[model samples]
Target: MSPEEAPARRRGRPTGSRAGAPETREAILAAARSEFAARGYAKASIRGIARTAGVDPALVHHHFGTKEKLFGAALEFTFAPALVVPEILEGGPEGVGERLARRFLSTWEVPEVRERLIAVMRSALTEDAAAAMLREFVSRELLLRIAAQLDVPEPHLRAELAASHMVGMAVLRYVLQVEPLASADPEELVGLVAPALQRYLTER
Candidate 1:
């Protein structure tokens, strides 16, 4: 272990350079992601994730509090909310759509995140529980938060519209892999999608 990692180990923390968590928490998150991807949110269990992480189920709960919180936290790290949220919030309401579009699409640019997101999206489509979990997480974490920050009327509806646009793009570009859109350049896609998102949040 490196000198910096040694102190963390001595204090019983797992060591990793991942943005969130020490070694153990990262391990749990990794396990959760894999489990969620493979089993879908409806079928995935804390016990299964714990088993994969080689930790006790209680340890998983202790780290994450609840399953909703755990999945949300895991998604947050994969989505890089900390890095993306502030960028979206900056520069006021002007051109926020482009920023949101760029940042949102950027999340899928990563191989790992994209792969897991696909499986999770599939689960959401086929499973009611999975759909609820995803709807709540995305709305609560990304869409609602962004819309509220802009002081929009009917923030919930606006958030859903923005999310619909973004999600539709994701389904075509990443999940369904539709032609043209799937092969399109990132900036081109951003330009094509941003206007709709802008109107959703900024217009009415």
Candidate 2:
């Protein structure tokens, strides 16, 4: 080969070089998030995520192990609720409504979280197992924790109501993208919604 050709020779595995592994993983995660958000858990495919990421389908399996694990990671990264929710509830029951509303709205406004939530909700509507998983997470992690902290007699009922209110608003604003509601100021929403939430937590 010519000297110029020799100097230009590729140095390592075409795509699997050690230096490229982290980049590949990030690409796969970004593509997987988009796929899961658009397709829902039941319809999203590892092959499709791999195709979008421009990697071998086997690479997706190698990275994430299984579709369920991928979905969990994608959702966790997208929503990041485990980090936010507890912080929101940290101020105790008196501040719960405002804190919850602010945090929920802020979290949902994130593009990835909004998309992931819509995907999860869609999956919950159509797939029983998906719905159960969603319910279990919300119930065990969110509602129950908040309920236990409250002084109300029907803490569970109040928690459910609060959850319903937040979920309903999310569906309308994020998923449906309904005009004014979709574009409404976050503070305005907090003002409007927090009272109802506060009442649920405090009232008989």
Candidate 3:
């Protein structure tokens, strides 16, 4: 065969990483995180991640099985609402704001998750790189997912605004302990905050 006629080299691993190899698994996870961080959960794909990791796509499926599971592994953030947010959505959109607010508040109240969140938040606050990754993960994975569910104009803006309110509330009430808000009952706070959130969520 002529040199110019040689078949193009196939990219990535030929047969995928051997099953149950820790180093290969870690490489796939690292690639998954990078893809997720750059492209967001909704847009990132198994094929793309595999390409980035220099592995066959089958390897990714072998390691993580599903996109949701892969995202969970890549993130390793127990405090993220991505898991339970859909359950909260199942009650319908009429009371999404109230449900979302209550859910967000309740999530922060978990003892183990709270401790881990504090550590992540502290790292983000202190490190520029960590903060950027955290910001992207929140915007793409969490906020965008919630926003896309709403049948509203400017879904991205709406999601961001609603999330801003919730994050601000969390920081003030839970982190900074700003009085009144800090001391207020969860139900009372939900009542006070839900209307604005509802407006952002449902209104045009």
- Models 1 onward score TM values of 0.74, 0.79, 0.61
lDDT of 2 by residue, 61-151 (tens): 7888988777766655655574565566567778678888988898888776677678777877887766777677777767777777778
Candidate 1 global TM-score: 0.74
Ordered list by lDDT, greatest first: 2, 1, 3
User: What TM-score does model 3 achieve against the real structure?
Assistant: 0.61
lDDT of 1: 0.77
For residues 68-167, write the lDDT of model 3, one tens digit per residue. Answer: 6776565564444555765676677899889988888788777655554555555557656556666777776776677667788998788789878987
Instruction: State residue 116's C-alpha deviation in candidate 2, in Å.
Output: 2.5
Better of 1 and 3 by TM-score: 1
- For candidate 1, write residues 1-204 as lDDT tens digits: 678778755754342233244787888989998988888877889999988987767678878988777887776665564346645766777898898888888788878878877877877788876678777777667765665676678877887778777878889989888998898888888898889888877785
Evaluate all candidate structures by whole-model CA lDDT and list the values in order: 0.77, 0.77, 0.72
RMSD versus native structure for model 1: 6.1
Model 1: per-residue Cα lDDT at residue 77: 69
